[model samples]
Target: MTIEQRYQLAKAQYESWGIDVDAALAKLKQVPISIHCWQGDDVGGFEVNKQALSGGIDVTGNYPGKATTPEELRQDIEQALKLIPGQHRINLHAIYAETNGEIVERDQLKPHHFQNWIDWAKKHQLGIDFNPTLFSHPKADDGLTLSHPDQSIRDFWIRHCQASRRIAEHIGKELGSPVLTNIWIPDGYKDTPSDRLGPRKRLKESLDTIFSEEIDSTYNLDAVESKLFGIGSEAYVVGSHEFYLGYAVQNNKLCLLDTGHYHPTEMVSNKISALLLFSDKVALHVSRPVRWDSDHVVSFDDELKEIGLEIVRNDALNNVLIGLDFFDASINRVAAWTIGTRNMIKALLYALLMPNDQLKVYQEQGDYTKRLAVLEEFKSYPFGAVWDYYCERMDVPAGLDWLDHVNKYEDDVLVKRANKS
Candidate 1:
């Protein structure tokens, strides 16, 4: 059947349940998903003298045609954006700064170092989000950064974060949108630490120093990300969830929850409602973790839907800054971004088409049976038709058609990079 016919029938099905599918599409279009830039190069940012990735995190598989230059990465992102529906923002790291063949220390980075990015962002009309590269640096070689034993190392990272916020501010001012400058450090111990409080205290002090300068929220918003463990710091992570949650609440900073940062049993989706109650805003790094905090591509799984539902049902679309955080070298990089990001958007669309008000009433009236029944019924509903119509209407490829575009682009663009390199 034609996409329009399918959408009309699906709209009727949802309308029967008192759900407004068109309104849901409107809401989904407004929600911007910050696409991570690192995925284009497998986190290999264009630093003059590059350092090996040192965080507990690692990107496996040696996929050829990885972006090696700033322009190339942007080109790959451009291709992916065409395939994915709706407007979105791009997430960048400190290491992505262009230094013009000169070695620039992280602390010494300035707004000019990223002017190329700012100019490009303006060209595409995409807002840019920023992150301080705490991992894969010399100072962090020992798996210590903000919580390092040495005061100098801690001061260095603090300065870097401070610089990052300024850069974010500049980007926000240029793009005319608020930027989320997130800080994620890999400072933990391989074995059990003798003193956890000491590192956490140091981390707290460093954060305070970094955020000492008052930048207007209009330009930049600061967020601290927490992790349970990593490749090296399996025993303890200094910036634990509890620590960051307390720090964010006390300091009025946003706490970034990476889906892969929690334990297997603990779901980041479950924490969304709790944070919304106290904080005015919360940030997310939507990712899929397998057995470990492995940054796998995000899938349209149950948890992803729950997360989307939490944001939509709670009326927190504006309050929650949704962003993606995953790197899988096993498949096409551009396809990785397209697939993961599409799934994220798809999950939200699914949530938007649900009869959330009815479900809430069922729970409130102690009618669990109806709630469960309605939820299962919608699972088999004509959700795909609505999704396809949204994609086609947005002028992007619907269904598996997007994969063909990525494949063609890979052969036409990405493969040439590998051949030259």
Candidate 2:
């Protein structure tokens, strides 16, 4: 049957269960997922100092055709967006600033450094998010930032984070949308630190200084992300989940949850309800971690589905900002972005298609068996058909057809980069 015919049948089947398929599609269309720019370059930014990635973060594989310049990265993103359905935003790190041969220090950066990006985003009618790159710098060589013992070093990072917030506000004002300014620092000890409280105290002081100047929320929002551990920080991480959660609660700031930033068995989906009750909003860096904090491309897996279900079931779509965060240089970067992003969209779409209200009703009535049965039955539904229809409606290629576009772009664009190098 044709796509529309299949969708009609699906719609009728869903109607019998008191679920509105069209409403779900509409809601999914409006939901904007922020695509991280670092994936295109394997987390390599356009900084003048081409230092090795430090502070617990590292991208594996020496994949060819990585975007080495701002122009190339933007081009790669454009290609990925063409195949991914729905309206989305672009997330940028401070290291991606276009300096045009000038040595702009992180603390000295201004909005002009990102004007090209702002202009590019405007052309595509996309909103932008900002992040402070707190790693790979000389100041961060000791695996400490914002919580460093040295006053000068801590001040430098504080200034840089403050500058990042201003830049986010500038972009938001220009684009007429609030920019989510996220702060994720790689500050921890390789071995157990003698005094954990001291570092956290310093970090808190640094954040206070960074957030001293209040920008209107309509233009800029702030979020703090925590990590379990990093390459060098296996024993202790100062900015633990508990630290940021309390800080966010006390300061009324949004807390960011990176799916791969926790232990293997710990699911971020379980934390959604608890966080939603206190914070006005939450931000997410959705990523896949194989065994540890290895940033792998996201897939349509059970954890991803659960994350989506939590957001949809709790009716927190407006309160949660979804963003992709992973870098896999083993494959075509554009295809990586497309695959990860499409999977994210698929997860959310599946969640939207669920009979959440019905499940809630069953649970409230203490009908545990009915709830379990209904959930299992949903697994066998024709979710793929609905997804294909979504891609068609969004004017993107459906199913495996999108892979053809990625292949064509690889030959015409990425292959040339490899040949030139």
Candidate 3:
């Protein structure tokens, strides 16, 4: 049968499965959103599992050894693009080996290295989502934790902020894309809270220095307003820090709605709404929220089913960049890529199937349960509706099937269990 006819049949089958068939099918047919891949830290270096272990780049350690040369990196990205089409991208780090828990100069940025990487990505036609202002970089030896009382340490962070702006302007122009600098400082209360007001003010002072005076002034400052609020148990990143950094930055700056980077009870929609109010260009980094940690997993779609629909119906989905924040056993890179891609497709499909008018009513009247029902109905839709709709409409990996991948994972888990027994 032709693709259109197949869609009609699938639509019918979806209705029979107790889902809102009309709305679901409508969502399925919409233009698929572009998927951006996060090029995790260099996979070339030594992988330290617990204590110098080389199994893979999993959750525990931050060391991703250098396995791919610049040329190889370009080739792998090219291969991924062919495997999965659409405006594909990967997050690029400006400074190499800058976050390896080592001491180094905080006042300088290597422009030549950044320029070379940008050229490489341009040649490959892949876009970059730059993660600047990261405290994990090597220059943050004294730590970007403003709570550091020492004058010299605070001075280093100030220098680091200046360096960040220069690098951002340099790379943003070369890449020709609005540089999305995700500012997530690992600076938070480890035990009891420190001088919250003083440290944060200093941090903001540092940021203000960059926002007001850093950069080549003329470069397009399409800064992505990003911040992390809390870390682990009881520790907080404080509003003064997140707000000053987010608002103090210039306008036209997009805010990155990272899934796992907020307090557990915080509402995701509220966060999105706040950013939407401030900037026209909003972006997202989608991931599963693990207990006290960012799991970087394919988030269970059920979590945001209703809220996601509301956001879309309100016309909020138009100018958002949805990026996948994922990680797996370094050895299981391909598996992570496959599953992460599927999860993203599912999220997009969920947004599409929602009825704009009905969702608006739910939002207007505060009928959360009604909104939730819409999502649950979609979830109950026929299994193959997503497969048939997305696989037919968009450009996905040729032979990669989600059902088959899950089955294989299950088989592997069972075998491992049996061996243990």
lDDT of 3: 0.51
lDDT of each: 0.93, 0.93, 0.51
* Tens digits of lDDT, candidate 3, 105-188: 545555554665677768866555554434443434323443356766656656665566667667667866655555545555
Write down the lDDT that model 2 would get.
Answer: 0.93
User: On residues 94-185, what C-alpha lDDT tens digit does candidate 2 reach at each position?
Assistant: 99998988888999999999999999999998999999999988999999999999999999999999999999999999999999999999
Give TM-scores for every candidate, taking all chains together and pairing residue i with residue i.
0.99, 0.99, 0.72
Write down the worst ten-residue block by lDDT for model 1: 53-62
Candidate 2: minimum summed lDDT over ten consecutive residues — where?
Answer: 47-56
**Prediction 2 TM-score vs. true:** 0.99
lDDT of 3 at 209: 55
- Superpose all Cα atoms of candidate 1 onto the true structure and report the RMSD in Å to 1 decimal: 0.7
The superposed Cα distance between candidate 1 and the true structure at residue 150, in angstroms, equals 0.6
